[model samples]
Target: MTDTQDELPQLMSHQSFREQAREVIRGMIVSGKMAPDALYSAPKIASDLNVSATPVREALLDLVQEGLLRPVRNRGFQVVIMTAKEHDDVFKIRLLLEVPSIREIAKSSPTANQMKGLYDLANAARQFAREGDLIAYLNADRRFHISLIELLGNKPLTELVASLRDRVRLLGLANSGARSHIVQSATEHFELLDRIAASDTESAAAIIERHLRRSRDVWGAGSGPA
Candidate 1:
């Protein structure tokens, strides 16, 4: 066979590899293993993940489109690094979109089953945090917060909030060493649920806003852009 024919199998294998590589990188971003502003090398990632360079390149390209990574001048891609001002701006917008939506759900007075599910998610998140399982904690925490909006019946708002929440996850992982913050966050969820259960829209909204703001504050203090 010719040289081109010799390369065909490797090319075909790579074609099937990029999809899985993309997912692995996305998971690392979401789980905070790869932090914001951290530099990434395609070859290094490929070696680490036991794949070829082709898939790593494809995965990085996908992340760039998703706004999770960006190219650096004459170098590799870096995690999308947000400044403090940018983080604050996003946090404010998130509060505007999510707090009221959560309040509306609170006002609707969801069934016991609905509230129980959220509580269960919160409990699971707390356990994950206590165990120092960052990935599990991140997933469970996302579920706990998004569950409130999901209960509100706002699909569009939920999608938007989820995107913004992805950015916040970076900050959360940066400051994940703060045990108090984790405990406080878990406790706040219970309080927010209590307010929701009581159908106190005003208090519930206030609680959520405060919860998000405090999280931003704590994470921002240490993890803000350098």
Candidate 2:
């Protein structure tokens, strides 16, 4: 019993480290820091993260299940290349999920905690935008959207949309015109949040559609399987 109890905290710590590594690696792949069609080793990534290989390897395996990376025999993992159609498909899914959801959120009026969380996320995205930290910006953006959608209490739907978002981000859309317009995009998020807080369902829905379309234009143009 003592041995089991002692191992429990270590297991939880490893799980926490694995999740952090997954987020860092995901942001790297999304921001074009980790190019597609390349193999990266667990030991090297572990060294960079200053963590043991166990957690890093576990994190890499988690990404493999997410369709972002694939395992190689001896090599660590290869970033998966996404085609233009695949990118479009992911956006389409987002549009399908988020548009109506935002309308609902506006009608329901967010709770105090939800309002605070949304504000924090929007502010973080805006700050990262001003700082030109593309990866952090994307991470904040993803969390903002996921938190927005999760208000509906649909776990499966949230997971599905989040997976699509990961696929879209891995396309390196933030590396192009999207980077130049980071502030603009972040501002749009702020506006959408304001509208939601005001219970302006129609306007919030409109903002959601326009925001996503602008992202598609900025990131989707001239990008294909790489």
Candidate 3:
């Protein structure tokens, strides 16, 4: 069968472009560039990012599936905003899941390659944080933490943790007052890796706890409940 003229539009559905659009849009949402409950149209987003609307729409639908966005009738997608109580509940659950998981992760003695990959991610996050690029920092930060959790060999758990991490409302993360704390936390990613490398499970768990609390207190600050 010969290709139809309609197939030209299909060019917009390229896998790499779709995935890139998805990640970029997701970063914008989670890094607090897209305010919660605000409606954003695919065309507007596409125009801003210099991409075709096709992949932008597809990306919006993907975020909707992730529960990060809600589709409005012929309008656009709204960022999903959680109540203060809901945010706190997610925070508590994250603490429960992540802190203990570090113990298991630390016992494994990650391969050198795994450690190197994580270090690269951690360094990227720190560098971005220092550069005041919240979006880039968030992407690297998510990967670094998720990589450590994956060492436990539990895909389900890793996905759950990642979803919860993304669900958080980081309202004040970009504030000047929060920059120091952000950098400190970014630096501590290395400390967490070190503790895990040394098999100091308790120490690693402590670092994880402190990290989560800062996330809850600093980034999530003014996001709702005190």
lDDT of 3 by residue, 1-226 (tens): 0121121122244456677777777777776667765778888777666678898899889988877889999989888867777788889999999999998788878888888898889999999889977667777788888888998889999999988888885343546545687689799999999998898989999999999997887655665444
How much does each candidate deviate from the true structure in C-alpha RMSD?
Answer: 8.0, 7.1, 6.9
- Model 3 weakest lDDT span, ten residues long: 1-10
- Candidate 2 residue pairs that clash: none
Candidate 2's displacement at residue 23, Å, is: 0.6
> Which candidate, 1 or 2, has the higher lDDT?
2
Model 1 whole-model lDDT (C-alpha atoms): 0.74
lDDT of each: 0.74, 0.81, 0.78
Q: 126, model 3: CA deviation in Å?
A: 1.1
The residue ranges of model 1 lying beyond 4 angstroms of the native Cα positions read: 1-27, 30-32, 35-38, 41-65, 71-76, 171-177, 223-226
Indicate which candidate wins on lDDT: 2
Candidate 2 lDDT over residue span 1-226, tens digit each: 1222221122235448988788878877776667686778888787776679898899999999999898889867888888888888889988998899899999999998899899999999999999987777878888988999999899998898789888886667644576567789889988998999999999999999998888777774676653
Candidate 1: tens digits of C-alpha lDDT, residues 1-226: 1212221122235346786676556656755567565677888777776667987898899878777789887688888877777777888899889888887888899999998898999899889778765555666787788887888677888877877887765544445445677777888888999999999999999999998888777654676565
**Evaluation by TM-score, superior candidate among 1 and 2:** 2
For this target, which candidate reaches the highest TM-score against the unseen true structure?
2
What TM-score quantifies how close candidate 1 is to the native fold? 0.74
